[model samples]
Target: MLNETKDPLPVAERVVGVRLESPLVGAADLIKAQEGRASKAFAMRELPFRDLVNVRGELSDPAFVAAFAGVVGCEPPAAPNTVARSDHYDVLWLGPDEWLVRSLAPVQTGMLEAKLTAVLGDAYAAAVDIGSGNTVVEIEGTRARDVLSRGCPLDLHPRLFKPGQCAQSVYFKASIVLIPTGDDHFEIVVRRSFADYFCRIMVDAAASVAP
Candidate 1:
């Protein structure tokens, strides 16, 4: 049986799409677990073997792409960086001129964005801090894509959604960036304010996908 009520309680803390049948803590309970939450920010359980690096810069510069591509020894395709990696770099394009370079070790975000900006030189790029304004939720387990497909339009097929690939699109009416980490795992980047509402929609969507 499912709740199916207009306002079902949220499970999975900062994450929204938790299965109704699975044990979960309430949103308020999850909030209480974290210490430094005043507003516009919250944290969830750290995802295994993954770290988030947010970078902001003028994505308009042609040289910017070239330098990034140089690191990989091939031209970066006309998409974001989640689909390509060199030893440890997984670039996920966040916007036209912005990208999120992910790796196992945390790097200085400002320094990296600065390096790109300096390389562009007079190309006039600036990197901004978006860590507090967004939430990056990693969706794993074997059935993850099946859960995401209910609300996301982008193809989740492994052939189409290879690792090191990322896309920004609307999920349940809220805009988000989807980064594929594995055949079954995905990283969801969403704004802070809509986290709760988005989680609710995700739970409903996931429940519908449950067998």
Candidate 2:
């Protein structure tokens, strides 16, 4: 009899049986506690499972710019501390040649990275799916900026840090990518490891300043 062999299942198939949880899965009660004060001053909540892709390329190259814009619906913001927004994505400037592309809506893991890679074919660029590496926390209300100002050193005055702008900064001990989505609203992109600490600390800060 001929020897028989079988091909192993793909990594994706093998992992299909796994269950995923948000980094802030353990902070449900903490978040609920803050919800009571949400209507008054500020509220904090985790926006989990967002599709985050880190893209890097030289914008000076015509091919790179074209390829990126083709896929992202806009050229990467060349200006420091700015964000390029599309109907489906918000491209936040992380460096002169690096950006974080965040989907406006959640998507199947790897779906965004695959689309970006396909469109940027052979270009001197990279698209990495870092969705599982971090989580987004939204803090909004009348006192949202006040709560952030407690730990963040940036001057959040409207004339200084308005909507459509982003900065890499720290919230107390956690390194965060801060985005101003509106006058009194902000989104913080923090590493998964720090999600718990960041949320707990933020809630405490908000309570101290609660009206």
Candidate 3:
């Protein structure tokens, strides 16, 4: 509907050409600038506007697992902390019975929710779209692990953490679902409310070692 050409918002809320946003909208630029002041050890940037859905289902129920697998086109991860990827989405395991599904393509709001609901029905499974409630940050550089390990307690060495791994853990003061996407890269999910604080933390760290 954005191409409808009519004002997207009511006339009272309209600004000639301004885009409505949150305080963190421009924080990425500031973080990038701050990273420039560092020693170029690693780099961090925000991955904005990803579709996220929080799912809780009965892992013991075959119907529950099959329902999501049909919609996601991949079986939900049953591991303690793992990730499964399909052509269109990444299903991250947060716990034995909880997972977070993220879409690779930009989708219309409510599309993911409706799609899952249709397949899930009124079963014991539950799915809640949380795309707007969380923000994803990517940290990767020559010494990405070194930089992240400063705040996170996880053992990021290749011997332990590797691709397709995901865990719910603390990063400094904020809680995050840390996903290892590559040997030198990670996707950290922080709550929107903590995004600003999280950005500041990474910026400060990246300043000492940005590349």
TM-score ranking from best to worst?
Answer: 2, 3, 1
lDDT of 2 at 84: 94
Error of 3 at 26 (Å): 4.9
Task: Candidate 2: give the clashing pairs.
Answer: none
Clash totals in order? 8, 0, 6
Model 2 C-alpha lDDT per residue in residues 1-211, reported as the tens digit of each score: 1112334766666566656688888888888777765764787878888899999999888998998888888899999999999988899999999999998877666678988899887889999998998999988888988999999999999899999899999999999999999888899999989989999999888888866
User: Which window of 10 residues has the lowest lDDT sum in candidate 1?
Assistant: 38-47
Off by over 4 Å in 1: 1-82, 86-89, 94-96, 103-121
What TM-score do all the candidates reach, one by one? 0.58, 0.91, 0.84
Each prediction's whole-model lDDT (CA): 0.55, 0.88, 0.78
Q: RMSD, each candidate, Å?
A: 13.2, 4.9, 4.6
- Evaluate model 2: give its TM-score: 0.91
RMSD after Cα superposition, model 1: 13.2
Residue 192's lDDT within candidate 1 is 61
Query: lDDT at 211 for candidate 3?
Result: 51
Which of the numbered candidates is closest to the native, going by highest TM-score? Answer: 2
Q: What is the lDDT of residue 114 in candidate 3?
A: 72
